[model samples]
Target chain A: MARRSILGLFSDPDTTANAMDALRGAGYKDWELDILSGAPYPEGTFGEHMPSHHLFKFPLIGAACGLAVAILLTAGTQLAYPVVTGGKPILAIPAMAIICYEGTMLGAILFTVFGIIFESRLPRPRVGIYDKRITEGYIGIVVTSDETRVVQAEKTLKMAGAIEIKSGA
Target chain B: MHNGHNGEALAASPEEVTQDILRKHREFTPRFKALVAVLAVLFLLGVVGFIIRLQDGFEHRVKWGYYAAVVVYLLTTAQAAPMVAIAPRLAKANWRRPVSRAAEMFGVVGLFNLLLFIPLLFLLPSTEGRRTIWFDGPSMSPHIWDTLAMVFLVLCGLAMLWAGSLPDMAAARDHSSGRRQGLFAKLAMGWRGTDLQWFLIRHRIGALASLYFMFLVFTHFLIASDFVLGLVPGWKDSIFPAFQALSALQSSIATMLVTMFVLRKWCGYERYIGLEQFWALSKLLLATSLLWFYFWWSGFIIFWYGRQPVEQNVISLIISGPYLPIFFTTFILNFIIPLVLLIWNAVRRSILGPTVVGCSILVGTFFDRIRLYVSAFSIEDVTAHALTVVPPAHTPDIADILIIIGALSGAGLSYALATKVFPVVNIWEIKEYMLLRVQAAFHRMEVTILAKPE
Candidate 1:
């Protein structure tokens, strides 16, 4: 058994739930931990209320910028070289509304996608873990505990349902 | 004393009963039969109108109506399909139990769009000597081959939809009974619920959906090429594909809404397509309608302000000309009317209000298509009173009408026939619903259990 156990990383709801239960049952709520998964797993599923994700909200902000840009683009074009087309109103609101709406949606989508990538910490500099089972179908459960409890926690999880148990050196 | 369901008084859970109804038996209520008859009739009428359209030669543009027909094509086929097709893909939920069939219906009806192209065939010299009072008209364009290819592609698109719908037809067929159905026996191709057949069918369904998305996009872009892409001034924007995509989505969802609403009361889908589902469909229509207005406006402003004199002529013609009423009606039907009706949550939640809005959108979108085509192709130089400016597009020539009518009749007839061969919805998927529900319930219990302190 390793001298210290720290379940700092991994993300699989099925396994995460098991490990969290194991830690809490063992009375170790203070252990540093994180999760990695292919998709967002509504952190509450792990028996903990996850920090709120504001990535989707960024679309709303992008929408605001979109509105400004649309107004500027439509009005500025007319202002820069006012098209006096048979003397009609140059700053057309009906037409401008379209511009604002489209631009805002576009901006919001771009930010939403980017926000997900940013929040995900995807495309890491190096491999976080080396296990083929994680990709195949196995949920990796990394448990990080203090020196005394590291071995105890590892034994408990491997007995519970860890296909392959590992620990920090 | 019989306190419980003893003779058949088993205390089976709700899931068991829901499963029994979904799996072993499903009856098409009188409401659905009536709806089916109504749909069939409406479809047949469209066919008849199409047949009537053929005789009057498409050799030359009618006084002002040719442009009107062309614009209708743009809105119906060009604008409506792309936006809604991607919705099920976007939501990525199994809850598509309610919407998938309607979405597929859009893909299927799109195939009939080629019938409208028959008018262009009237210009060919080959058809010149081929004059029957009702069936003969020279082709409308110089290239008969291109026209033929488009017509062919539209047919192929329809075939793909037919093949995909086989399983659903089989399900619907088996689910019906008595003289209550005549169409199913003829249409159903012995769907005896074999495991081997079900697996083969699923593989085919997946393949066709991918093909529909890929080919339909190409088919629609060709529309831009066939109509708008070639037109100058208004045609300059490269965003036309995006516009067409959004428009198709709007129309498809709007059409789906109308179908669902009609089906519920008329087909007894009150149990099937519920209020929650209808609301979902409306929300989709509303979103895309908003998207369309945005695209329409952006395209408008670009030319309205860019004003290189040539473009100004097109703009002035649309805004104030003899064409203003058509444009405004298009706006109201496509935008304002549906928008006002659907904006109130209470109204959209109502049974008929959403349906009316949906139908209005469908009709408006039709006018919108007419507006796009006629505005781009025909411009009235004279500024006359509202009534004096332009008349509705004249009916199609006899030959054009025949081919178009025959094609649509073929679709309705085929859809009726196709119903007998497959179930209307995914039968296997319906079975899976209970399992998912049970698992969900278990997962909830597990959470509660774990939450309790020792």
Candidate 2:
């Protein structure tokens, strides 16, 4: 009873979404299917849960870390080697505040890219079922199911007018 | 370009749109060549002016802080190009599709801004006993903050542009051949257009756009504080940074409008960059212009009402001094011209009217910068904050004129080159908008509905 990964291609999003809804109605779990398109297709078009993303926290974390680093660079260095000037304190608050702001933004920007890379899980081995036509305005619906549900999925895809289908080991 | 997103595809297919864009990118017309050549000559003259000024030494060069101010203003205003790309996206404005890439490409001009700022570092007055922010420390100076802010802004702008353009790069990679294909493919970052990739790109764009918006305001604040406010004697206006930020917005909007007009007229992109884009942008320009006046009035009224001799001296130096004409011209161009022209619905809805208003604002902003920096730099009070009642104002020399021409050319040339390399229109964004936008009948009237499916 080996599970099969079937990639059904549709010419438009409506057919693809209908196919997905049909598959779900046939008792397939949300995790068993994925959708792919060239442009960013609106989420939930395929009647499945959108994959949750944790990339939002990266900026917040990076901002806090940046603020700390700014403190060390502006305050720590000044305290270690005090150079009095214009009756200003060794640790100038305004200058340090500017430095802190810069550091926070720097960290946020850096970590955001990192978060995207991590969450996308890019550069992974192309293990799942896929299609090249998806890049040329075709919609792809990838469904993985047990042997019994394979026929049901195929029927659902055909009824929904899948232009093509491919099976992956 | 106006396609019903949810129902039938608009007048053209995605493939056809892509072909149209690709054709435009490949063809570099004679008109484009002539424009670039003119800008190039102007830039060279400015460079020669800079060289001569540098050779004349700091004593003489200090007088040319006005030259530095001109360069800084032009370069800083060029940043509005990227803001044009980012702001519309954040607001989900459908009309932004055709022009976002053009706007984003201007971010590269920040490189020239950084290079032009190097000489200004040497020209800055020392901060030994002066009430400046540069604390005495090894390798610590106000220049560091300015440099850091400039570098960060440039990087953020570039990064945001790159992220937004990746899907388009992949599209190009799929359809091109030879070296172009290879380049696009590499830049595409191995995109296969999976749901995961799309999701990540959306979030990444949001993060970068937010960061860029924050940086735009913050960096302008730093530039205003370190360069202009810090130099002027007895000029302790808390609202100065807000004023400068508003001015940047106004100037940037003007620049964006001018660029859009050029693209639509010369590039034969009339159908794409139509009245809708101009109409939306004109309203924004009007709003920013009003805000700009409010901030200026706030600062001016405070100084005017105080009537303290020091504050009065500051006012005369700015408003009624030798730079009197420039001050008045700035008000007329930035505020009066725009206010008069843009208030009419007919003008705001038309291309010619907004373009005229935009040009006026740009000219006004240039003179405004001159008034701010020239008067402040000329005030050479090193101790006890003695305000100069009548600051010496000299007309621009040959070198000053050349430098200004060169800075203007430099910004134009860099943006033209960028357009050549990158797609001037965001094809992917256009496609996405096509998918999401629909025409519907509401209240027995035909209307457009933009669906946000999450």
Candidate 3:
């Protein structure tokens, strides 16, 4: 059984939501369906599955790593050089604080960017089964299933008011 | 009693918005080409001036004072312009939708600023025996650290710009043809407008914006402390860096306003950018203008009241001495002028009034930088406990004048080129703005209902 991708484009948000419902009602799994739109539609606008992400942890880990590195660098340099200025302590915590703060921020920012790229699954080698109309205010319900199931999915989409349906393997 | 003139409503369909915005790429008018040509010529002249100045090298810090002023001017204005976009977005302001891309487009100037900054690194003396944030950290402390901070700030700015423009890039990729389509496609990174992608991009933009703010403040602090305060002994004003950052905030709003006005007036984008944006930003501009005076006063009053020998010299060197004229101009242009003009509700609500104030602030900021950097750089002895003698105001030489013109032109050129690459107004954000709001009849009046999504 060959699996193919079917895209049902709708101009109206209500129609898109109805198509999503019809696809699910016609035995399509949530995993096999994806919704695309020009603007960021609020989650569950189409009654679609909301995926959870762990984006928060990336910055925490990065900040911790940066702080550890900064502490070591500041403390290690002080210990190695052991310069006494006006009988201040070897590790001048106050002086090190600025660099430490900057380092932590830099790490957090870099990792947050990385986390976005990773979490978003970006740099996608190809935009599979996409419609140019989706970038022009159209909502697309993309269904990837076996050929036999795709026909039923197309019927469901049309019956639920999809303006156009596109098929690709 | 509502103002009926909010320009035209965004009544265009999403596809129409995309086509209208992208149309600028195809229809590069003679005026635009002439503008680009003029900027390119000026930038080339700036390069020539740079070459002429390079002949002097880092041996004479005074000679490079104007150059330093230009660099900091760009830093505080162009580089800081993105904050207009960032701050409003963080607050979820509705009026920022059309002009957000205009603000973010200034990030492209950061690359040029970075290049101009490289020469100053050599011009800046070592932190040895000087009171600096670095203290006794390392031999190359300020140099290495400042460079790192600058690089990080520039990268963050570019990343924020790219992240904010990602969806627009996808629109460009879809609507464009030939080489442009290829470029936009690569830039878009196969963006398919999936739910997950949109979610991640939003988060990324927020995080980058937050970080850019922090980095901007830190960079201002470092530059102020190292380049200016550290050079003049017995001038330890903690509020100086904050003053610098605050003035930057004020100037950045002005920069955004000026750019927006240009887009609306000249670029035929009046339908998208309107009195609403100008009016909203005018209030902020007025607030920052008042705060600008407050910060300057907060720093100045200390020196004025204390009247110590060191504080007196510092004042004389910076304020009442040879730079007195420049100081007065800076004060009036940056504070008094904006205050007097923008204080009125009529003026604040009008497009021309804010744009004029913006121009005034820009000129004021330029003179302000000249007053600060040139005066600091004129100091012959960095190791002196206090300024024994005040150096006369260093006027711009031929090269300095050329560099100033060139630097300003370069920033403009970068922005104009970027407009061609990315849509001048954001496509998706504008569409989102439309989707989230509706005009409803309320009694005999109409009201706009805006949706706020968490």
Candidate 4:
């Protein structure tokens, strides 16, 4: 059995959202539908569970790794080649703390960027079923389902005031 | 003027504001050129002055406090510019769209500061030999670590500025012609405003803003430690670093106010930059000013009550000694003037009133830096038992004055040049915010209701 993808373009977010709900009610799973728009609408506009993002613990992990490296670099280097300054101990806690802080932030920033790229799934092999008009203030509802449900999906989108519908593969 | 009681009357469409900003961006003006020329001359003068200082040996210029003070002051002012972009976003204030691009342009000033640091580090006394908080390793010195941190921060500032400017570059690319179109297209990196692109842009901006905020506190702490606390003998106040950071925020807000006034008057941005923005910023400035006083008082009270001879001597040197005039002036300008004027609702609501307060804070910050760094620089380690503060043996030589003048001009020049290259307003942000903010009747009055995504 082959799957067919349908894209419904609507002028308003409300219409697109309604179409998304009707398609889901017709036995389409949450993962089979996506709402795409030029502007970032509030999440869960289509009543789907919010997409999980890896950004949650990415920066924290980065910070931990950074802290370890910073300790090794600051404390380890000072201990390896000791040159005490101003009667202070060779390994000054305060001086090392500054290095540690900077390293942690640097790591967090690096990881946050990496997490964004990973979550966005950018630079894909190809953009699928995307309309140029979506960037010009159109709301696009993408639905992939069994070929038998194609007509039903089109009817649902039209009922919700979709301006245009395109189906492929 | 649109009066209250009707929600429909006050709502502005996103299309209208975008067109207005784009029209302003396309227009070429000669006024910016004249300002740039003036700043360039001042910058050149500062460079010549620096060269002269370099020619004079360290023995003649050992009172390097004055040099370091000028460098740090300029860097602090430059650093504050980014907060004008970051703070409003973190706070989620909608009025930030108009002037944020202009403020972000100042990130380029970090390059100048980085270059200026070369002299500061070269002339700085060695860490192992001096009684400071810096540590030494086989191949690495404290100054090396300091430079590395500074380089990292400057790069971060530049990256944030560039990332924020990309969407505007795309706008410019689509709505322009000839050489400018190609330039903008190249800068845009083929942004088509897809859902994923917008998501990534928004996410990156938030992450960068948060990092920058934390970095501000961290960088200021390092600065306060290296240049002020580390140099000053018997002057150990744990609150000084936080206090310095608070002062930077206060001065930065003031700088933004002044910049906003200039933009509104000269760039025909009066419609975009409204009194509401100034009113909000004035409140922030006032709050920071009060906190500035508290931090100063926190340190002052402890030192005053301790009655320790060393602490008392350092306090007297900073207050009633040669630095007295500067110290008192900073207190008045940084705290008293801003506090009194900004406290009045009438003054805080007006644009000119806040701009005046900003000017006072800027002047005060300059003097405050001098009082702290110069006083520390003048003292000598004559014996193992103690070091006493004295008047700086060396005054501002011709080079020092020129360097200070140059730094200011350089910052202004860089900002002006940046405006010509990029839209001085964040066009996309304004459009996006316009979508969220709708006028609605609240009880009897019509007010703008900014819907929260949460």
Candidate 5:
């Protein structure tokens, strides 16, 4: 059966780093250490990979929509309400330029907002879990190490000044 | 408070800092209070003027006065890149923090001006209602399209404003007092600031910014064409829209700087809008002033070379005409004052110098607009009717002066009101600063440790 271990979260970065060290030194190199966080920061700062956000698609998708909208609005307006002036064609390129420009920008802006929100995974469960200090610039590192290293890992973390290193399942 | 985040405690217990910030917020300064009082006076004056204009009925003077306000309104659409130009590169600020607020607030305030212009919309007298500022009296054929387009522009712009304001709105909602339930709450759409809400909120902001960029271009061109479409001699420069757009951007930057200066000086925001910001903004003012001069030179040079009678007459009259003093003053104020002051590192670093220079540039840009539009109108009306009237000989009629003051007051009131809540600088950016900088320092230490040889 997997043992459940509870780690007392520190609201401080040094303490947290120290705790991580303690866990590593206590033979819990592969032990599970979890950091309930407030802000989304990269684990890489403490020697781990930070997750990438889906916000990457925003600029590209938005730009495409903007362009398409610009063209459609410029053309659509000309066709919908053709006003020939001084024998000039109803769809004068110069006059319709304004609509195209505005429409494209509007599209991009609309999409940009959607993209950021989508990437954030907003409007869902926001349980008040661990380390509120994370919102205030604290870095929390939670790792599930292999069971063999738990004791040594806890000792190392303790030496490093970890406030708490609880053992668990 | 000056060293707001001097602790290396990694993550501070939130109670202390939050209490400290809240305490600081309560300690409102006299200078800002004084500014707010001044805004109130100006707003009252503007309201009186508006009432008087409505009662007196729209004549050439009153009508053009409204146009001047509209021109200022148009300018807000392209708030210059003062913060963005430097904040990220210089401060190494975080992506999800301080910058968004300024852009968001500016958008929201500009929307207020947009609503204020609704009176102008009603002022349009059907076939007779087509005002000559944004377009040549929304033509019957295009009026339908034009009106719908304008409605869309306004709707999209307003929606963007609300969307962009969401996160801030949530922050404000949670932080706000019982009495402090202001516009944000009314417009917040039940934004609980949840993680789920963040997705829609962030998406809305992104969409707004993209649309804002496009809207600025449209607003720029649309306003210029409206005024110049009458083929008013020197006023008929095709580059007028682009020039107006750039000048609007410059003025907006100057305005933002001035706003920051006041916010820092009065609200005790020592860390938020810092000396570094002053330095960066001063440099921007220097660069933008040069750009302003470049546009002015190109436009004048082309006219001088082409030697068109109408254009030259319009040009020479301003350079050496009875209005020469205002003309030269505009140039000196806009270009020279900022350029010379900004050259020095210290001058840029100093708060007073840049604020003064920025205010000066703002004045100069406005004067330039007046000289270009209002003064030109005086000449055009004279030439068209084959009559002469000396504009400088008479003081500005109460109505003319009031409109300008009223418009400025509108901007001022909005700014003063905004700083009361949102930290002028992004709180998150500062947090980023505290974190990344610490990491970078430790990273360097690691390099040293790795590099050491026994």
Candidate 6:
């Protein structure tokens, strides 16, 4: 069975919410439908399922790696040269603090950026049943189902007052 | 929802706001072009000045002091401008929506600042036999670390700018055609405003904003320590770098206020940016102005009370000696004026008052940099334990003046060019702001009820 996507555009948020409810009532799971809008409405605005994410883990991992690297570099350089300065011992923790701080921050920033792109599913190869009008303040409810169920999904969308319906394989 | 004075509503429907902002964004008027042309010419002159000054070479460090001052001035002012958006957004302030992009757009100037910084690196003397934080490190310790910090800061800034503008790029991609459409499509990276994408964008922005703030403070610490304090003997003040960072915060807010005023007064963005934004920012400006005095006093009081011979020399060189007039000017402009003016409700709550204070602080910061950097650079020997004699003030030559004008103009030009690529007012933020607020009657008064999303 080939899956197809159906996008129903609505001018009003209420109608969009109704369309989501209609889809839910018609045996389509929350994972099968997604809402797109111009503005970032709060999560669950259209009664959509909120997906869990692991963005917080990236920074912690990065910081640990960075701290480890910084400690090694600082301690390694001090031990290699083994020069006493201001009567301070080699492998001075105080001396290495600044570099360590900067390293941790730098690593966290880089990893967080990578995490955003990965988690966002960015550089998506295909837009998939997207309507340009969605960026012009229209609300789009997109449903992904088998070809046999496309007609039923389109019927539910029309009954909920969708102004336009776009379908794609 | 109506602003009352201009007969313009503060809130508009999403579609109306999108079309209106995008329409203004696409327009390339004669005035805007002329402004860019003038800045370009001035920038070219600054380049010529730079080349002419390069002929003198790095041996004469004094000649390059004013140039260093200009770079630090740009660093404190324009490069720090992104905080105006970052700080408020972190606080979840709704008033920041309209002016957020304007603040972030200043990050584009960081590239020009980095270019200007390369020459200063060569001009800086090696740290051998000098008092520095890097006690027993490699020969290129400070230089390598300084360059990395700057590169990291610039990267963080640009990344934050790009991440914040993703949704707007999507809007541009959908609405545009031809080369612009292609360019925006690439920049958009196929953004579709999915729920997951939005959640990721918000988290990314938060993370980047936090990172940018940390990097900004760290960079200021490095520059203040290595570029100025490290060069000037017997000027060991831990508070100095924090003071510079504080001033950067103050100056960045001032920069945003001035930019907001210009956009409202000239760019026909009065509807989006208004008194509410100005009024909200003015309070922060007031708080920073007070802190400016506290930080200056906190640093100055140590030397003033101690009166050690070396401390006295440091004081005379920067404060009581040849640069006394410049010091007074800086004091009045950066502290006295803002404190007096912003203390008043009438001045602090209005658009023009903050703009006026912002201009004052900008000029004050310029002289402040000159007072610090030029004086530090004029010292005869970096290896000396204490200043033996206070060197006379090194006045700006024509080349110095050109560099200052050119560097500032270059920053302005970069920001102007960025506007043509991205909308100055963030479309989605403004729509979200309007979405979360509604006017309701409270007894005899109409007040706005704001909702915070979890």
Point to the candidate with the largest DockQ: 6
The TM-score of the first chain in every model comes to: 0.67, 0.86, 0.90, 0.85, 0.59, 0.92
DockQ values, each candidate: 0.02, 0.47, 0.73, 0.28, 0.14, 0.78
In model 6, state the lDDT of residue B216. 95
What ranking emerges by DockQ with the best candidate at the front?
6, 3, 2, 4, 5, 1
For candidate 5, the docking band is incorrect
* Chain B TM-score against the true chain B, candidate 3: 0.98
lDDT accuracy of residue A138 in candidate 5: 44
Evaluated on the second chain alone, the candidates' TM-scores are: 0.67, 0.94, 0.98, 0.92, 0.76, 0.98
- By the lDDT metric, which is better: model 1 or model 6? 6
Q: Lowest lDDT 10-mer window, candidate 2 chain B?
A: B1-10
Across residues B381-429, which tens digit of lDDT does each residue of candidate 6 receive? Answer: 9988887788999999999988988999999999999998889999888
For each of the candidates, the C-alpha root-mean-square deviation to the true structure, in angstroms, is 15.6, 3.8, 1.7, 4.2, 7.5, 1.5
Best of the two (4, 6) by lDDT: 6
TM-scores, all candidates, are 0.53, 0.89, 0.97, 0.85, 0.71, 0.98
The TM-score obtained by chain A of candidate 1 when compared with the true chain A: 0.67
Interface RMSD of each: 18.8, 2.4, 1.2, 3.7, 7.2, 1.1
Which portions of model 5 show Cα errors greater than 4 Å?
Answer: A1-9, A13-91, A115-169, B1-22, B26-38, B58-62, B66-78, B81-104, B121-214, B229-235, B316-322, B376-395, B439-454
Docking class of 3: medium
Residue-wise C-alpha lDDT for candidate 5, range B396-446, written one tens digit per residue:
568667766876787668756765554344443334344443323454352
Q: How much of the real interface does each model capture, measured as fnat? A: 0.00, 0.57, 0.67, 0.24, 0.13, 0.75
Candidate 3 residue-wise lDDT, B1-454, digit = tens: 2342333546667778788888865578999999999999999999989989999888999999999999999999999999999999999887888888888888889988999999999988877777788878885778987888888888888888888888989988988889988999999988999887777777778888888998899999989988999888889899999999998999999999999989888898887888889999999999999999899999999999999999999999899999999999999999999999998999999999999999999999999999999999999889887777888888888999999999999989999998888787887788887777778899998888878777
Model 4 TM-score? 0.85
- Report the lDDT of model 6 for residue B145: 85
- Candidate 5's TM-score reads 0.71
**Per-structure clash totals for the candidates:** 67, 1, 0, 0, 60, 0
Tens digit of per-residue lDDT, candidate 1, span A101-146: 4455445444444543354343233333333233222345455556
